[model samples]
Target: MSPAFSVLMPVYAGDDPSHLEAALRSVVDQSVRPDEIVIVEDGPLTDALSDVLDSYERAQGDHFSRYRLRENVGIGNALRVGVRRCEHELVARMDADDISVPDRFERQLAVFERRPDVDVVGGYIAEFDDDPDDCFACRIVPTNHTSIAARARFRNPMNHITVMARRRAILEAGNYRDFLGMEDYDLWVRMLSNEATFANVPSVLAKARIDRDYGQRGGLSVTKAEVRLQRSFYRSGFIDAPILLYNLLTRASVRLLPKRIRGRLITRYTRTPG
Candidate 1:
């Protein structure tokens, strides 16, 4: 029998209701369905978003549930709280604006079956502007534990929106914490330190929504967050002084470039055409 898993997703004010509906529909139409889906309302949502959730809940009946937070917490904290309420050992993370591929869960589960020592299984994700079917680029990562660990020092080794991880492994690694844009990166680093084994399916697991203006989003605050993240990595011994300085100079400086330049740089190096 396949292992039971729960899909954990969090949504807030900024999420698009239409995108959320599409996201839900993608999972619902999966080749292998989840036992349940636990949605976290990070804060009060617009009536439109609430209505979308309501429809899914009504349609899914007992298979769907939601937990509302009294106020807005960052995605990391919201997920930290929400993951605790999941009723299964394996939990897959989802984002309201992303659509999972139909066989995503089945593929990840197959990895776990073949590699029982793996604590986390993730795969590549496609980045699309308007339609999931027409992806422009893909974010691919290393497939084995060794390469994943080595690459984690320079960049995120797994797609946060496409991972199926063991709840026990996550809790042991300290769960998700608030780190602005660095939450998933931080957690993965900690999990690596905890000696958790990981693998990737080497195929698209989900399609993440991106805007044409993706490069224009970062600013001074983004640079500050990058600095803070590097410092944490240093303090945790994830990186040494030399590697830390290298990142501050190379990665942090990239963040301060003109929006067009930054976007071009990211698109040139980080993405592959789908």
Candidate 2:
């Protein structure tokens, strides 16, 4: 018998309507179908989104569950609520804007079974240029826990959307917390502190939606990341001086460097053979 998996997803009030359906389809079409799908409607969603989710849930009937939040409690809270409501021993997280490949669950489940020491697993991601016309970026994560955590101080190895974790380990780590913008980062640190192991599957598991207007490399998101990185380093007491200096230099050169070039430099330096 295929092991049951629960997918916990949080959808904000203003998510792209089309993207939501694509996300839902990705899960429904997974090679190893999930036993339950929990969509936490974070805060009161838009009427259009609500209607769409309602229609989708009705179509699935008892195959899925939708947990609607009366008030906006942020992603961490929504995820916590979703986790509590899940019945399966394995929990996979899906983002409302990303598309999971059909074999993602099957591959992740195999990893979990093979590596009993690993408490969580994630995989490579194919990032699509959010532009209606052009393709932009794609990347893969390290497939080993030590390698991933070795670089964790610089950047997160696991894509939030592609994470699958053991329910017991997650609960023992105190689950997700309210960390403003870096909730996932905070949780990963906590899990590591608990000696919970993590790994990444070598295969591409999901497609991330990224656009020029997304402003991840520049603008407010970058600023938020800078603050969050400093805060995480302070809290973890594990940030390396070399990595810190390298990150600062990249941030300073953001305006002078091309996006792809800067991205490559950062990714390379952080994930360099160490």
Residue 14 Cα positional deviation in candidate 2, in Å, after optimal superposition = 1.0
Residue 180, model 2: lDDT of 60
- Deviation in angstroms for 268 in model 2? 9.2
User: lDDT by residue for model 2 over 130-152, one digit each (tens)?
Assistant: 63223355566777878888867
What's the lDDT for residue 201 in model 1? 86
Q: Residue 147 CA error for candidate 2 (Å)? A: 0.3
Best by TM-score: 1
TM-score, one value per model: 0.97, 0.83
**What ranges in model 2 sit over 4 Å off?**
130-135, 217-229, 240-274
Q: In angstroms, what RMSD does candidate 2 have relative to the true structure?
A: 4.1
Give a tens-digit lDDT track for model 1, residues 92-156: 99999999999999999888888889999999999999978898888899999999999999888
lDDT of each: 0.92, 0.78
The TM-score measured for candidate 1 stands at 0.97
**Going through the candidates in order, what is the number of backbone clashes in each?**
0, 0
